[model samples]
Target: MPLNCGIVGLPNVGKSTIFNALTSAKAQAANYPFCTIDPNTGIVTVPDERLSKISALIVPKSLVPTTMEFIDIAGLVEGASKGEGLGNQFLGHIRATDAICHVVRCFDDPEVVHVAGAINPLHDIDIINTELLLADLETVEKRSQRVEKLARNTQDAKIKTEASAVAKLKATLEAGKPARAADLTDDERTASRELFLITAKPQLYVANVDEAGLANGNAYTEAVEKRAAEENSQVVRICGALEAEIAQLDPPERTEFLESVGLHEPGLDRLIHSAYRLLDLITYFTAGVQEVRAWTIRRGTKAPGAAGVIHSDFERGFIKADCYACEDLFKYGSEQAVKEKGLLRSEGKDYTVKDGDILFFKFNV
Candidate 1:
């Protein structure tokens, strides 16, 4: 239930800097390799304007926003799969995460050191991805070896299928492709999941640019974006140092700084939103005068499953949910007006919670 994304890249790609900006935490951003030995975990509030709008109408004494966790993982290096330079430890941290934020350096500054000697965003991407694929290839090969041994001794169809699955995975990984790009059937995919391949996790690219490159991307950012498009991944442009400065300012001052920089909002917000989507997550609300709060759930989750996010008992005593759209309330100016127009309705356990839904649960327990 505690889903998180691991920020990963080579050394000094602004991974820690962007993380520091996102969480405003002092996680140590030194211009050197392996500065972050252990992954630094930080919880950040997921921004949603609907939460404030819902609070305004309901007049809650306290309002709470849902959060996502970000893990600033140690930088990966070439030959990481061969146990090079704290690679195994960092790769383990990445495996624990649900998704990945692959940070790429799209800026050049004399003060920051580049791990690859020069900026080649494509080569940087290839290095990190190759390491992950190599790691997964080893895992698949090992799993395949064990499964093949089992296959020769038994006539179990399931075991044979598993062996075949790992065979396919091995071939894909051997061909320098991630396990996700492998052509697997349903059973094969299920079998592949058991390996917990690092390459299988969904990912988005973060182009850490300078202040000038933020508004209009530079050549480096363009390269990163093009590479992301080729891989069918998303790219989020962020100026790490500037965002760190913006994060320290007061809300009023932050707004002023943004306007002065020709930005309507912080780039971190875009990064957060992109990561949320990469995880296939959605937010729903529970409204009341006591506390209006937002909750996170996977897309296409049923009402009972969503209720389970709050507490087991809510899901145990399953019932209907009274739900309305936050946008409807905003349009109508009040919840009463929304209800008067029949915008509110009761939904059964089969109801699929939406991103902007305001739900009121009806449970016996």
Candidate 2:
């Protein structure tokens, strides 16, 4: 899974700050507009307690956790669709991501100037979303122009199907709705995927609050939450400054700091986990004496597809998979115990991999 989420919003809304905290990559989070001109991408390990538990059980020499990528894209302005403030470059970066994390400023700090001159989350969200919608509209229109001509002149079934999909997408984008909202069949969706519309990607709204507003959100966050509900999206509230400071501490000190703050975990962990789920991804494990490793796969991936995440040879020579739920391990206390209790399963290619599954792949290779 090379899939990644793009952190995007108007300038000075803590997109880079959150990104820097998320990856601890030092992406130059300044209090100025367009500070991040180039997209900064970082690989982040997904926090999973099961990985540690599996390591404890197997006593592996190495514990490898699954990872996901995050891209910090430059902020978008009001006229982004018309190339305002390097908008074209920024939009291109967003188009390449699998999902979106729109960071909305919910705290009013006079020192950190708001790009729109006020902390209005709903307005800010509309600005970025409108730009994305406009960009998608343009893409659909351009693609429709070429495809429509071919579909009318030639009776090719493939060309006609593509033209129909393009028309549906154009109508949806023109109405200020995302292409994802359009009623398209499976074949039409397959055809429309080639368009690569930014608005078609799943999105999560990130409400960046001050420390005081982290536990109970402010008015701005409430507004963001309301809008997200209307759009059937999720919102994750985080204190950007606090998380940035937390990112600088050692592991032990970090735990102490969080405990002192009356918190169990840093808010960045929740944000990372939310972004991972936004991609509709799930994790499965391979535990052994050599290593206890977590692997990422899409939600409905079959046994062979899950094995392919390890190596192509595993998929090619796949025989079957010996699998058991991690919860079964927790119950039985050992693999032998799990097998004795008849909790282990031997699944073939048709078996869909479940999250937290402990798998021993059987492959000739």
* Best candidate, TM-score: 2
Candidate 2 local lDDT, 92-124, one digit each (tens): 999999999999999988899988888888889
Over 37-152, each residue of candidate 1 has an lDDT whose tens digit, in order, gives 99999999999989998888889999999999999999999999898998898889999999999999988888888988998898999999999998888888878879999999
The TM-score of predicted model 1 comes to 0.96
Highest lDDT scorer? 2
Off by over 4 Å in 2: none
Error of 2 at 35 (Å): 1.3
Please estimate how well model 2 matches the true structure, expressed as its whole-model Cα lDDT.
0.92
The residue pairs found clashing in candidate 2 are none
Angstrom error of the Cα, residue 57, model 1: value is 1.0
